[model samples]
Target chain A: MTAAGNHQASRSGRRLERAGIRDVAAAAGVSITTVSDALNGKGRLPDATRRHVREVANRLGYRPSAAARTLRTGRSGLIGLTVTTYGEEPFTFTEFAYFAEMARAATSAALARGYALVILPASSRHDVWSNVALDGTVVIDPSDHDPVVADLVRQGIPVVSDGRPAGNLPVHAWVDNDHEQAVLGILDHLADSGARRIGLLTGTSTDTYTRLSTTAYLNWCERVGQEPVYEAYPAHDPCAGAVAADRLLARPDRPDAVYGLFDPNGTDLLAAARRYGLRVPEDLLLVCCSERAAYATTEPPISTLSLKPGRIGTAVVQLLIDAIEGVGAGRPVAQVMPTDLIVRASSQRRSTRTTVSPPRSPEND
Target chain B: MTAAGNHQASRSGRRLERAGIRDVAAAAGVSITTVSDALNGKGRLPDATRRHVREVANRLGYRPSAAARTLRTGRSGLIGLTVTTYGEEPFTFTEFAYFAEMARAATSAALARGYALVILPASSRHDVWSNVALDGTVVIDPSDHDPVVADLVRQGIPVVSDGRPAGNLPVHAWVDNDHEQAVLGILDHLADSGARRIGLLTGTSTDTYTRLSTTAYLNWCERVGQEPVYEAYPAHDPCAGAVAADRLLARPDRPDAVYGLFDPNGTDLLAAARRYGLRVPEDLLLVCCSERAAYATTEPPISTLSLKPGRIGTAVVQLLIDAIEGVGAGRPVAQVMPTDLIVRASSQRRSTRTTVSPPRSPEND
Candidate 1:
């Protein structure tokens, strides 16, 4: 262990009461300003003097109070990550692969910049929101009239959202995939693979992701002169997804290809196809938006529309931190990240194609 | 919007500057103490008076300073959740099914009690740890001599871990599955299914979970007079798990059955089995520990040993909160949670099995 580690251990063991900054100043025979400047890397000081003050502080177990620091600096070095839900239950960030991956990347990015992410709920009690001093916030999917976002923005706190804001909601910045372009690309890919008609398994929620993807699907169906055939479910409910998949497949005029908007839709549709004895790619093509690595190893390897949540998460944190630190302060920045379509056996019709594209490396995503 | 929501929306829209408590008290025509008491549901205040004060404060968009409140009450509603990493990179809580599910449950449990979770790295810089005032902390897997846990404990902060502390490390409370019993049960289950030999895929890290599970496996092998055949790798790396799985199957003394200790091992092992032209449950029986729902929908529906992370997460948070609020002060508490084995097609022998156990409902866990 380093000397700092050893000093910390010894101090933790021997010290019965917390040490204050005054003790460090007195023991080191240095003024309070010198100690403060040395510890905070503020005013100029000699390297030897700074090291001597730090060593004395560490030896004395002198630690600053977070409350005092926050009050003094008007900064907490904390960023809020709001999990938005469309139902009564608060959104658990791990419910979907997209959220899980996004949160992981966000945490990494925040830590890289010496900030920590606090998990907050969009619909939590007002006290829950106000109990922590956050420099900025990253809301997953703000509602059309999300009161929490409105409140944060009103307080002049920089708020960056993972999904595009709905209605006239205000956010300092946002990072989101091109939902319309991604959906259109998937529909075209399915069509190119000999899909006569493509249906959609979408969410009933009005979040920007769901609403935009569903609208894109409908617009594409209209432009291509095919009637829209789709089923909507409460995406938060896992069983509802399976039941909705069954309903989509059970339709008398069931489309030959299906695109799902949520993470678990691919498996739900696969199970539903099994129930109806519909072979994938042969009878129906399947695709869904997911960040789960398990999909790559699934039987027949289901095709997935990768939202590149890691990139989005990293970008959101960078924007939020930039806003918090007064970098790029004027105009709110909205970045549109590209999506990846991981083509797999589930989406390819083996019997119809004369030329086949080689499998793309998963690392490209 | 309700009256409260409408007031908040209006206040946020019109207020150019933040409202102080003094302003709220003056506007409400009440003493500062009276306003505070009414807003906090304290003191001898009538229901009508309390309602009036809160309404006035809401209308004025008066939010108490978190730093001030924290200093005055000597408490912060923020709870720290430390994510420990064994490799160089910081642990991403969503990397595995166990962590993802555990964190989800922990977040829900904390929110239920009006607390929010803050994600912190176990190896984060000291300033990061001191930047937030946390009422308590929940360490996922503390090292044998984790300096962070020691420092937090020394500061009179209550810490509850999700895994048993190795060596003589101190923690306020801990919640962990009975690893020895769980591993023995799985090995015996495999034996009962007419397996001649069973191999193991485990991690090289010495965390309590891995240490206890691996020790149990070795002890079980010694008792049965069978040489232990296992492959150990750094579990944090996904590609390492795949390579390790392939190596285990390529061994000259490869066991007829294998149990993997990580979430991704099931799919990795299955893929390796295919390379060897082996059929699941016929050529090799396979099982892995996981909390993922995808395992049930795999090619042959892989069996899994579930650590019941949700239960452990809830239990850990409950214990930490109890310690923080002095629910059961003094004696530290240790909880042993139960594990569930979800038997699926991959772990069952088709031809050798004379009798079959009915499928257990997943909700029983």
Candidate 2:
């Protein structure tokens, strides 16, 4: 008897009604071994035979049970991405340009490695977490001693984080931009652009990014013998940002140059500057941390601190997949990437025209 | 003997090493029935007991096996969201404001219903598809005869689409905007604004939205006895949009007004109009279909046709989850929703300024 017949005899009493591997072999006129090899790309076979077997299986609507496959391989090929939410809805986290860009790159990187990325809220219900079998997880901006991160670590699931974990949160690996260094560089750039005092538009969030950047700004101010001038607001609330920007400009001790720590701050600051009758690069210099392309086309295109979210996204996934596959089985891995300073017309005292300007058009501000 | 003793006696041989309900029962000094009731939110259980049981379970790092649960309950609590990609990466599809808003609403809606939404590329490989056990799926703008949709339907998976299915493709349910009516309304609005000649900026894709809108534009032109003048480009290609916008303006018989069918068309057409020294409203009226808030703050605040993507997203998920739960068992559901026309300065020849303007800023144009 052939191997196909033996296989059929063994499982016929249990699952004969469903379209099994035996059914595919019989339909394609191939042995069970040949069918298995063709489906899995295991053994060397003719291209035509493999295609034929796949087509036959597809026609029969033969699907390998995900649950059964999990039992056999012990891998679900799923990576959970925990997004830090600022509002009740988890999707509000992606409203920022930085988060959106980072997520896109991470999704692309994960897909290229044959794993599907699942977006799970950081504050997801226990049942939601228990329903999906994740090979590992990637946490973005984990809070200090996050319960979710702690639970996952205790469960032995490898976790890679986009932002450096605050406090003593245990993470398998982490990829983050050098936030302190990036902030200092931006402050220096504004100082060199002939600004008397430099100010900061920052967030009240306690996440590592906001905290680190604010600290760096304060340190820079102290080192330069200048008092820090800044306004802080709840970044997640859309209306609060504009009010804070207006308040900053309304201050009696307003700084000549300002840097915003969030994405929408560029526009908010620009509108504020207009209300004060201050032209960019003349009375006010503007810069913001963002990955939005719209800033490149703004009136007097705004200077921006590019966190290079794409690189961070790719690095986090690579480190995560490596930890999952046990490529580097040692201590935790930490990667800190450099930031890019995109100089534009808004940040310069004199129009050097260093960057390529758009097509000649009437400037409307 | 008590129920807890019987349960422990029956399962002690197989899973004594692992933390089980018996472990929780013994630790909390409760019956096994009480532990199960507290954990599942079933039966009359005090809130304190439920919280205590949950804390113990969390501390023990005990997770219900997703595979075993699937076998027992036959539901995974997972919903697949198939995003139609315009490029190689699935993330590019979310670059549009309409899509981003729609997805956000869908994610919010799914989470509210106790289901975690998974972002799956519409062109996902077979392995990716078969690796997750999804109770239902939400397909966004399914192509005519989409193999993925067909395969899912064959496997008895419920699929609810955001757009109407092309051809005779079988779908469990669908929700779509009134695209033809939306187009006709926008054309009439432009004509009413004293536009002698109006043109359209459309896409070359054969999807239902593009096809319906384009056909409606053509029919409107015929009704007005004006020769059709429009530019069609591959909407997925980012750079192609700007080139097409410029091409439309450079024509000898240039249009006095134009309506774009995509999101970025507002910015692209504005730049093109500037290059020709054509002022908005005075020379060339502009409008585009978008859900972007940035358009509200543009120099001449461009008019926009809002497809109300949030409503559509919520409706699609509601229909899908309803079908998944076997609620309202009947024929397939089809919902057509209305669109909103936001008339801004760019669409009006003589600015009546009916809408409340932003805090007056210096206009350089």
Q: How do all models score by TM-score?
A: 0.88, 0.86
* TM-score (C-alpha, index-matched) for candidate 1: 0.88
Per-residue accuracy of model 1 over A127-165 as CA lDDT, tens digit each:
888988999999988878888989899999999988888
Top candidate, metric lDDT: 1
Question: What C-alpha lDDT, on a 0 to 100 scale, does residue A354 get in candidate 1?
Answer: 24
DockQ value for model 1: 0.47
Return the lDDT, model 1, position B113: 86
Report interface Cα RMSD per prediction: 2.7, 2.4
Where model 1 places Cα greater than 4 Å from the true spot, the runs are A1-16, A44-49, A86-89, A92-94, A250-254, A349-365, B1-16, B43-52, B86-89, B92-94, B222-227, B250-254, B350-365
Q: Taking the tens digit of each residue's C-alpha lDDT, what string does model 2 give over B1-365?
A: 76657756777678444476667776666877887788888999889999998888767656777776675676877889898766676646325556666766777788788888877888777678888888889998888899999988877889999899998778999999999999999898888888888999999988889999999999999999988889999988888999999999999999999999998899899889888888887889999998766676676778888888888989999999999999959469999999888888788765443432222221110
Predicted model 2 interface RMSD = 2.4
lDDT of model 2, residue B365: 7
Q: Assess the local accuracy of residue A93 in candidate 2 as a C-alpha lDDT between 0 and 100.
A: 29
